[model samples]
Each structure stands twice: as structure tokens, then as C-alpha cells.
Target: MPRFMGFVRMEEGQGNPPQALFDAMDEYIGKEAAAGHFLDGGGLYGTEDAVNFVVKKGEVTRVDGPYAESKEVVGGWAIMQYDSLEEAIAGQQDFAELHRKYWPEVSMVATLRQIPDEPPTPAED
Candidate 1:
């Protein structure tokens, strides 16, 4: 089955709707799991807590903030296992609708990719 990464973006300083969003996400995940489409999902903190890294001249520079300066930053994300890109997209659309209801400025960016047979190794490991 193919896997999808759904990135949920929201405006900075917008009140964190973690509880409400998580509630809706829980419901969605339950339904998807019942349908055998859900794999795993979770929310993330603000950009201040997220790390940013850039590779330049074979050297990596680490920054203590989000890499992007758009009004919206990645607020959270979900990974869904599905049979096809269409199915993954359908799920993204559904989540987008839910977000629209509670967060008008929220935007969802989704990418569907086949899960690798072997997981990528961490640099330190």
C-alpha cells in the first residue's frame, strides 16, 4: 500500500486549536482505521520549537526556527496508508474540509509516496 504525508499549515500566532483539531483528527483517524486506511498521525508544536536546517557548501547549518516565512507554518501532520494516490488525495480533501470549518486560514499539503521497504537511517546512528 502507498503511504501519504499530510502537512497541515496554519497562520502563526493564530490561537492553537490543538484540542479541537485533535478531536476532529481522532474522529477521522477512527473512521479511517475502521476502513483500514489509517496508519499513524500526530500534531506538532509551533515553529519556535521546530528545528530548521540548511545544507550549504557541504556543511549543515542549524537554525532554531521554521525554514519558511509564510503566514502559515506546518502546524501538524498525519501519515495515512492507502492503496493509491487517489485514495490518499481523498483523505487529504476530507481533512481539508474539516480544517476549513474550524480554521479558515488552515491549508493542507499532501504527498503520496510508497513506503520504502527499509527505513532511512538517522545521521547520528
Candidate 2:
């Protein structure tokens, strides 16, 4: 089985989705979790208290959020496992569809990508 991550991106400060959406999501997650496909997932708070560390010219600088540069941020994510990429895609599509159906006015994107089984080699200097 291959593990994949679904990054849920949406506009900042849009407020929460509808209760119906949450209810639907709860049901969906429950079903998938029971099937052993959904490994873990959760929503994230706004970037109001976020912190970032940037390195430039071998110097480290700390920057605190809420960041002004981002119009959209990843508000949620999921770690899931599937037998094939196609199966993962379909599962992710179904997850996205729930948001589309329950929150028609809001725009959301579920970016799905597989998690590598082993660490990659570090870049050479």
C-alpha cells in the first residue's frame, strides 16, 4: 500500500464551512477510517499564531504570522493509504466532491500527492 496526503487549500479568512459540510465529512471520514484507508486527518487553525523560520545567506530569520503574502493556505490535510494511485485519486476526488456539494459558494482545492516510502538523498553542495 502507498500512502498519500491531501492538502486542503482555500482562501484565507473565508470563515468556516457549513455545518452540513462538517456532518458529511464526519460520516465520510468514519467510513474511510473503518475501511483502513484514512490513516489520519484534521483541520488547522488560522495562521494568526503561525511562525516561520527563513534562512538567507547562511543566516536564519524568524517571521511570525499571520502572513500577508498568502491569499490561500492549506487549511486541512489527510494521510491515507491506498493500493494504487488511481484508487487514491478516486478517494481524494470523492472527498473533494463532498465539499463541493455541501459548500457550493466556497472554493476549495484538494491537492493529493503520494508520500515517498524512503527519504530522498540530500542535495549536494
Candidate 3:
């Protein structure tokens, strides 16, 4: 099976949804995970808590955010495995629809990208 990442983006200023919406999302996520479509996922704190770094010629620089000007930022992500790209896309589409239905007041988007499959290497004994 090929793996895919479902990247979740949210518009700035859109805080967390209600408890009911979180409950519903939790239910949906549990079902999908039990069925093996959802391998891993998580939501992130706002950009104010984020940090940016740059490294050049062995020198490192760090920048802390109040990264306020960006209109959208990644808020969450999901990893899934499926037989084909279409299947991966459809699975992500379902998740996106869940947000649309449960968090109608918030703006969220999910994009799917295929992860290259790699065979596991044997352990040295």
C-alpha cells in the first residue's frame, strides 16, 4: 500500500470549534483509524507559538513568531495508506467533508499528497 499525507490548512483568526464539533471529529477519526485509513494525525497550536530557523554555512539563526501576516497556516495533518492515489484522495475528501459539516463557521482545507513507498531494511543481527 502507498502512503499519503492529508495536510490541513486553516485561515488565520479561526480558533478552535465547539466541543460538540470536536466530539464529532473524534468519533469520525476513531472510525477511520479502526478501519486503517487513518494512520496518524494531529492538530497544532497557533502560529504565535511557532518558531522559524535558518542555517547557513554552519551558522544558525532563530526567529520567533507573531507571524501575523500570513492568511493561512497548517493547523493539522493526517497520514493514510491506500491502494491508489484516487483512493487516497477520496479518503481525504471524506475527512474534509467532515470538517465542512461539523465546523461550518470555520474555513479549513485539506490537500492530499502521495508518499513514496519504501521497503523496510532488515535489522543487523
Query: Which structure among the candidates has the greatest lDDT?
Result: 2
Candidate order by lDDT, decreasing, is 2, 3, 1
Candidate 1, residues 21-89, lDDT tens digits: the string is 668877988999898887777777778777778799999989887545657776676777888888888
lDDT score of model 2? 0.94
TM-score, one value per model: 0.73, 0.95, 0.83
After superposition, candidate 2 runs with Cα above 4 Å error: none
lDDT of 3 by residue, 1-125 (tens): 88888888888778777787788779988988887888998888888878989799999999787677888999888888887888887778878777778888888788998886676688999
Off by over 4 Å in 1: 18-20, 66-70, 105-125
Error of 2 at 81 (Å): 0.3
With a 3 Å backbone cut-off (N, CA, C), the pairs that clash in candidate 3 are none
